[model samples]
Target: MSGFSRSCAAGLLAGATLLTTAACGSGAAETPPGQGDKPEVVAAFYPLQWLAEQVGGSDVQVTGLTAPGVEPHDLELGIQQVTGIRDAALTVYIKGIQPAVDDAVEAETSFDAATAVTTIPAGEHAGEEGEEHGHAETPYDTHLWLDPNRLATVATKLGERLAAADPAHAQGFKDRAAAAVSALGTLDQEFAKGLSTCKTKTLVTAHEAFGYLADRYQLKQVGITLDPDTEPSPTRISEVAKVAKAEGVTTIFTETLVSPKVAEVLASQVGARTAVLDPLESKPSGDYLSAMRDNLKTLQTALGCTA
Candidate 1:
């Protein structure tokens, strides 16, 4: 609510182009007159966008920057998207995910979700681009959405921020956030119970995006590649194969956005099959809850969890 005016935001973009890309490129669509007098909340990608919608409820106008099926890493922002960020009351983002979105958000209106939780150290990543090409922006991994408990914490904090932004709808924001937290709590419990009796604890993924999930569920994640879009080197693939074979890994997990060729090759090398274990970087077929539930079933089957 206390950010740049429309005229001020437009004036700031002096040399902006005529063609504009909507933040709601997918999953989320803009609402008619929703943000006209309401607080405008801009989310860098799907998860944050979904959170804003859940927590802000109908009190805020939510705009998701990333489209469905598009990878959020290294996303390119257009003039309109940048303008929207400048004009928004709050711009929710994970700093290391999209470099373009990282640079576009101003401190006054920006809320980096990664700051809401304690982060783990970055893993050793060796892809075609080498180690530096990975999550080097922050010391910690930015894929915090994998853990339901941590995401619930973010939901609570986001609710507080929304309340602060729009005092008139303060109670509404807090109430919605509480409901989201309760839902996430239930999901976390399901994951804990479902993954408790897995025969194999090692998870092989094409991208090392599941560190948080692995940490939460007490499973080991052997990622073939470190960064998104970067190809895995032969040596790295071989290394993971060795680990997979040794750990009795039955499946090499793939994601929606990234190519599954590497995962398929690894699966063959380790004499295992490939399964889709969404890291949730983009919009999923269902919302976050449903997709995560699907992932739970996939993990239980892949890990051979009896319980």
Candidate 2:
């Protein structure tokens, strides 16, 4: 088989595996009575998992479908993972971000149409041009975690859903969710304060993942190298280089798991630098707040944000 064919097959298999993984897992540690004895929550990606922890608190147990180092855009779910979701009281996912997730959501609906499936409209995209430009059909960018404001909104929504499911601790869930929203506001402020004063608001990201971040912070995403989840074309690099030069963007941000080759070429062409930006696809060993804090510093350095 040729290379493209092999890659396509690999992606399909990987996506399938991710779907299976999403369904199975050790449930939340047992909680005392009245706090919901069998409360379980399954989140499609890392950011949602973080939000779940914040809102669900000890009253609910949460697990992330996509593992560390896996790109959320192309995740696969396994049968076991699907089982976990089925067993859970609630399962939350951004419907359109990954094929694996879309498939899982569909399957869950088929299994039980009454299952709670909240679809978040991924925030609109503010960068690039043409079809590549504008909002993705996904209710919003599943990357809601990046936008503290959107995250806060989703947290509240999730809190309400979970509370209704287990009414015993409804008030507790509300309190925890309110606290999570406040924390999200604080994190959002940091990004806003840091990026607002950027010497240059234009950023060159390898993928369009930063769309929500850019929109929230008012940063201009000058150009992206790849076409959606696919790799960048050789000629596309030239257009990106021109945009980078015209915009005076000093840095091109690439994520941990993706190839930096296109970023390198784009950087060299425009005499720019490259930096690694974490997409937070998996739960950081630390909590969501910590991960955002780390990401804030990285963004600060890349965008030249200062005290």
Candidate 3:
């Protein structure tokens, strides 16, 4: 196997072994990926699950609360999902990424001390009135996963925690984290190359969700719609058209979960086309690396990147 894949295998084995150790002593039975076993890991969403897997490779057993093809915003974890969280050694969730998961985590009195939770903010939207109220509930953007630079922070913390829980494989966790970071760096470079070559440095999107991606790639954003929490207004579309014409944007991009009506309307006015891109709030078809690579390919075409 390639070095990276080999490292992944080793880390997964080590993590699984560690989970076994923790589960045995606690009388928590080990369960396979599909089976809902306690003393396991429960991720609130897909990206977090994928990250947990990267750090907890074979040694940790994980289950995602949000299934594939499900949008995080509309998710409502049932009693069975709650049981999964209660039985896990850790639970990772992006705050504000999914209101349902955040509500469950907040009201959860049973698994308070057991699950490890992480929140990804919606850039600046997190500060709006409804989301933050305390230290356990603070105001912060929950989309940290979208920014590769910020993801390094989450990866570092997860690696340390996994190492602490599994001392025998501490070094292995660290090594895997390093590998993940390297892969993220490559993904970021691809974004940089593709976006930097675009004829226009500005992007018009159906929503403001791409702020993290735009900021990372040094591209400006002119939103054709409003916040993810709300839909677009006729005036907003007109304003976005003005910005698109002014900025010379080539395309109007829309995310998978959201409606494309606004993008189509905005595109027509500005004589631009629309493209679908995934925000990756749910479990993607591939791992994090592959998901990001696909996103890059779509961006290259949408933005007219030469490279």
How do these models rank on lDDT, best leading?
A: 1, 2, 3
- lDDT per model, in order? 0.78, 0.61, 0.61
Higher-scoring candidate on TM-score, 1 or 3: 1
Which candidate's TM-score is highest?
1
Candidate 2, run of 10 with poorest lDDT: 108-117
Give per-residue CA lDDT, model 2, range 1-307, as digits (tens).
Answer: 2111223333333334334443343322111122224355566667777777788788655656666656666555456444444444555776555554555553321111112333333323333332222234433444556677777887777677666656788898899989998988998888878777777787788876666777788887644642354565565677778878887778888876778887888888888889877767665768778877888887788777777
lDDT of 3 at 151: 74
lDDT of 1 by residue, 138-229 (tens): 76878899999999999999998878766778899899999999999999999999999999999889888899999999998888887756
Q: Candidate 2, which segments miss by more than 4 Å at Cα?
A: 1-36, 106-140, 226-229
Residue 16 of model 2, lDDT score: 40
lDDT, candidate 2, at 68: 62
Task: Give the range where candidate 1 is weakest over 10 consecutive residues by summed lDDT.
Answer: 10-19
Which residue window of length 10 is worst by lDDT in model 3?
Answer: 106-115
